[model samples]
Target: MSEPESENGAVHEAQWREVRYEYTPRLADILAHLRATIVVTTYQAGKLLVLGVHDGKLQISFLSFEQPMGVAVGSDRIAIGTRRQIHFLRAAHETAPHVEPHGMYDGCFVPRTSFYTGAIHGHDLAFGRDGLWVVNTLFSCLCTLHEAYSFVPRWRPRFVSQLIDEDRCHLNGLAMQDGRPKFVTVMAEADEAGGWRPNKATTGCVLDVDTNEVVVRGLCMPHSPRLRGDDLWVLNSGYGSIGKVDRAAGRYESVETMPGYTRGLAFAGQFAFVGISKIRETSVFGGVPIAEDRANLRCGIGVVDLVSGQTVAVFQFLSGVEEIFAVDVIPGMLCPLIAGASVDKQERDVWIVPQPGSGE
Candidate 1:
């Protein structure tokens, strides 16, 4: 049989796609209660969106980047994985005199540095014991960035034979448990080049890092595995739901079935923030349940109550944008932004690192 066609198949290479978005009035009320800012990456649209509520209205700020996918936010920094690089950014003071209409905060994420990792199909990113660990999908392995080299191979799914350009298993998501890489999601355990393409609609599984076993299976294109407390939460993308995995029972139970192709997963307090992408008629998403249902297809973020499993609020994108790869929450940051490389060189150089003599 002929090999299944890649979902991306020459669609974006020839041109650029535009993105436009709008959030509902309810989004402001929901964000006000949480008092946290959200960072979402849309690889398809090549943009990073920061969401917050300011001045009794919803603040949606965006920064342009090339195929921005994985996002991880720390107390003082934010990490974003793009097509060929990983960016490290610092928060622009939560409270400052320059705080503008965006909110009490300036909402700027000044680019501290970036790693040129090449095109490794960098997916989920997390700051682990070995520094910045990334899901290097192209090599079917997890890797960490190094100042002297491209990447340092961390671990690979047991089924993968050798590191190659082929995205054999399509390892896409990473989860950290107890400050270590715990579990990962893969489309399939195919050890051949482009082997995972045929199983895009099925054969998805979650691998437990400690035991190196497929803890859960029979998923439809899953992504974004996150460990919250003791629960392993994941976005079953093809099913358009955010759920938890029961390793002992081998059950994947749904906490909430969101609209669109659910992918990004982040949490704040008791609420779960999920990113949903408008399902395009591609080989990867065409026949999925989200596309079949048709009634609820939307591209935006869904805020759900973890305990009640109800969608509390939504920030919808009416047009221009259609896909999201990752989502992150900036805890305690009401308004935040990333200055990026576009900022003035002099302004970007404005930092205070004490010299040895200054200490005297």
Candidate 2:
């Protein structure tokens, strides 16, 4: 019941939680055959979803963040993993307006930089070669962003030794690769404290950051590992599946199963969007298997078909969103928009010249 959203007329700046987004005209013909634009973060509806397409309809844009979990999409930049900060969004594209069959720019995306690092349960966000790599999950570790210190830990899951806040091993999910920090998804390699709250279903695994090992154990509550091209995609979220780890036969390969409780993951060519959720009866969603026969829980997005693993398209959400924690993919964006900050036309325009002709 919150839904505010306004920009050029600038009054209400952000409020979202009245979601109701549905898709499946083959998910708008697969976002008009991959012209792309599907951002989504929803850390339990603190919201930040874009999901575009213009004239033929289906827009759905919203911003307001606080719990907005992990999402990283660079090129024009966007980092977002809020709940203690790490905003950093850009991409105004010279004031945006050029529209028409692909001049493309209904896009806005505004925050320009935040990076606080307090709550520590930060979860995924990756840019690497050493820059914005946070998954600090209450210090199970993989941090970076300390120009004054709050984080800078780097990597830790060699069975998590120190730097404590005791989320022990709920170390969410992260996977970078060439830019570094290669793989991670935990729910239980348990060091203590919440000890992954009684193995949230199956003692999930998938560690392997250069053989620190645990290359895929009996996962069920995995989250997003994604590193496609030589494969390493994960999202076994308490058994709603979407696997693919095998790092030289350590085992994980499921690749498709979605009706709820999968966690966000993204990728475009050959597909794989994943991110389902909604099993809420709590005690951390009871005995898994997508909460067994609870009439098949379901929240949204499950495109999958990384070469025939199935689920061709879906976008369901039949109500004001419930869960969905990160799903990037904005390649060739179609109709993006953000403008928030109570928008006085994106903050009454500012100026800071010096890089088009330069000797200013």
Candidate 3:
């Protein structure tokens, strides 16, 4: 077991694990009384909550609908963009808007009828130096980064570029380097059009954002990538592994594996946090994800030491909730959370999500 240095010598984050319920608000003297925290992400059933750690609490933002696949995070206010609707919300743990019971919760910032006027799919979003980049992954494939305050036609959205006609895989994960784009996908230019299947074990490439061209291929279902020093540390979901890419050598190596389908990787200080979906029902040594397997692999948040390559802490899912999409550890706060999944909406675990001053 991984051990962390604490006030008491070697304490593990596991000492504070519980079901995702509303029983306790903060940490209790005893570990057993803690309730798991699951923030209401706004992706599909609400998207995954994307967190950027700050002072003592996590600043959470998520996406919704189809086009606005990004959320705006502010110091005291936050906004989530849906297809044509955007909800500018006050920060949470329980902050509410000045509306009535329903409207009391920060409501829509933009209406749904205003976005996706034609046929555009927003794949990724990032905070630009003075704007935001909303990527459209298919059809007339394009990457457009816009000014943050340029929310109207007067400023105009800047078009990065389109992929080569032969590069057919969806441009899903994107990052900005020095005010430009760096993107990754499941296939590349030399790839056959329909070869971008999730089940197959394939490694495509990472696009050089400046020229919007394919630079690296042969990635194993890579998801979250962070540009560290001279390497790109990426969470490769296909092998349940975290890897680093030699930017100059163009090689991939498996760092470690948690033995499940993994995605959403984030770094806090010296630790790496990864989100693993339900334990692959029944994965066969790198085959596609199996469908009917009903086994849950204690999914939650896993914390590892980047330097030593050891998993020191884990916060498990509870109260029938089975999966977490992402975890963001804000500074100061002992427990950090971003987005998680309820059993389902029919039996929703609303308590997992938090606002500025909410009790329920």
Candidate 4:
């Protein structure tokens, strides 16, 4: 709740970067009601933000990372994909009450391990039956991490002739079903370097990972395909809409369109939490419907009522954040704290050890 202040009462530049934001009063209420915490990564700001409710107020904890992109949350672990490494953190519930402001947080994620994946531009991640599944955008394939090598290739679009760092198809979203990678969303089926950039607005499609077949086509730069129950949901990013893929009809059914470009998506009960970002006004973002009104674009998380397809609450950034890469809901955790990788000495001091009389 406190920000660094200077002599004139303005935020200080030398201290930690100031993050200004606003949210509907109900946003905190909704999170508290569900007993959940929202985690979002903003590569543009190199931050992983944890949003929760503390005493009927919005509490935000910012952790530093190097261009953090993909985030995967499980029952007891959280995985974060950065520029050149993937960090794994395990929740140490035993020590949650000791986290300063003692008892304010109900969960504490302590960094436990990391794997160097080079600069593969890894995207969406999910824990599956086989372990961690990553959308390796640079190599145009789905891969898993290993201790001996950077990554082990699992699946790729048949159109991609070889594994290379060209970002050929811009394969960025992965949806896992029944503990396995089921579907993915890509900008295009292009097989050449940067080939998906030109027609990104119209060539985006979703592919079945098992069959390597395009399930739906002609999307508007789609990202974050997810399976909620029996429905296949995806973000039509360029058009700023959240929709579902009608597999039988081979088309996308728009559910709700937000005010900004949408990318990240997560589901909690009957609600969908979506990440919204402003258009960059570059050729990369041109020719998109949402880009037409850049002045009204917003950067925040929109809580959508899936049953009604209407946004019920919003959390907006007034400054210091422009884009969001991933969003995930941490269920049953009202407030949580994440120790950033090497950001402060506190992480070094915190330790996780077995309880007395526990087996070694």
Candidate 5:
């Protein structure tokens, strides 16, 4: 795409171009007609693992990405965590699925003496008949996680599945198997141990929802794993590849990745929408308050061609520059959920969640 202005004080237009690999914006008039909704937000912001409209409310969860990238999820009754301390809450309306409070951790990771995992950072989560399954990446040494280091509060999470050893990679994404207790994680790299950080696993692994076990191993930083119409799709966050694995053969390939930092992912019908966060060093700033950085740098959404591995459409965030943290496309529901913070950090917004999967 090219931006050309008129020499005289007149009107100028933008346009897009079609190339072999990328779709360049044309220099002419562009259409502007798109909208999205906010799901929810927490005071502590960083890496994310879950976001979607479940039951009758929009649910959002987060976990650190790098060190002891532990996760934090708050249900109406109380919040659960794998941080530095062990904690829990007894609530009256805790039975409610929504209303999960933030900031408070039911438990935290204590190192050395309490080292099963100081903190269990994660990406995807699934709740089935068996129980709640959380897939996460840990420092290779974490395999030695002890009972005392269980920071998941009273829940005593099954703490299932992890990446392979040797290669340090972050298992950033996860998805459930339609009706079974099966789950999948994506390895961003085709072949690597882990990210820059050590003690991480690189190989991809499969998790048994029934048993918290690192079933498979050896994969890159697979960000998001999804089961779409029987086909498994993995957003290899690091490789910028959307791949699929043939369960029978156990083979996968690098499909495609949108241009930029690809974090969370979801599906609405046949369309695959990805949460694209604007690169900080790549931003113009434009005097926009650092608080608004998320919004200001927030580019729109992009649609991926699952088969062709290409981004067909992009929903930009130039309007207000929202730094999209995570996205979940709910086809069964009317509207999808986009969980993130406004640039200014003054307030946290839960724009969507009108009526639990309601596209309101």
Candidate 6:
């Protein structure tokens, strides 16, 4: 796919068949300035988009995945939660120069391993000190991957009476602090199967993972709880607002509101990158604040100035994609490529072997 030059420095258009997008010109500049690349997952479209800057232009690489949701980025690897498995890809910087359109990309991610999780409806993921943590939504608990079983249950809220695939509560979003799981966000504190749906709009909350206590409540389908230093930030998803939790007072303070339903969130330097999606008029998304202006909602990422509480730039999808689940930033990587798990020749033919005389 090719991108047209910025139209009067306002919009940069990129199109490939039905997948069309237009982004603010400054979006490319920000990525270039930070030397970072963005990875977005759209389960609705079955795609994982790697967006970066290449030779003064914005470049996007689309990779196929089945119902890709959560994304966890480590120093040299990335973990992606999909339909029934979690895929792990390791960065192979040595192969970067040899990728097609040589030398344009600085990072090449190759499939390293995968773990079958059996469609537990995993949401957010994080690499904690102990191991890879997954918010196993269907089971209403946090779990880790294990070779002998689908998943090893780590922790579940006290209110959950049993470990079952009932989705008693939509337990999603995890925040790790100092290498350990610290806080989590849940759609509701309900204890019965599908119990959260009735009052999901006003029953959302944040929980202190360590104490298993509800620290903040009365949220509107809150997601993406992130701890930046001492501040606990989250997306009041159903309401289309980004806010911070006042743990002591059990409240959430809105920082800024956007036009779309916010879900995925990431932080880099002084800005926050949030994934926004247009909600479908389904029973699950019917009565939310953002739904009031559903027609004006967008599907893409928004760049927010954390300090000034302003949305600085936006990259919007015009067609072929909707409902983004996760957003992650690959730091220090300007342009990157991912070899997806596909049967295509490009993925099958690629091989990585140690250099001559190097230890294997």
List the global CA lDDT of all models.
0.79, 0.75, 0.43, 0.88, 0.38, 0.86
TM-score, cand. 2: 0.36
lDDT score for residue 152 of model 1: 91
lDDT score at residue 15, model 5, on the 0-100 scale = 25
Better of 1 and 2 by lDDT: 1
Please give, for residues 148-167, the per-residue lDDT of candidate 4 as tens digits. 99999999999999999999
Q: Quote each prediction's TM-score.
A: 0.87, 0.36, 0.57, 0.93, 0.46, 0.94
- Tens digits of per-residue lDDT for model 1, 216-302: 998888999999888999889998889999989999998888778889999898888899888776676655667787665888888
* Cα shift from native, residue 23, model 3 (Å): 15
Q: Cα RMSD to native, each candidate? A: 6.9, 17.3, 10.3, 4.1, 13.7, 3.6
For model 2, the local distance difference test gives 0.75
**Cα lDDT for residue 302, model 1?**
86
On lDDT, the stronger of 4 and 5 is 4
lDDT of 5: 0.38
Better of 2 and 5 by lDDT: 2
Candidate 5's TM-score reads: 0.46
Model 5, residue 55: distance off in Å is 25
> What lDDT would candidate 6 get against the real structure?
0.86
Residue 100 error, candidate 4, Å: 2.5
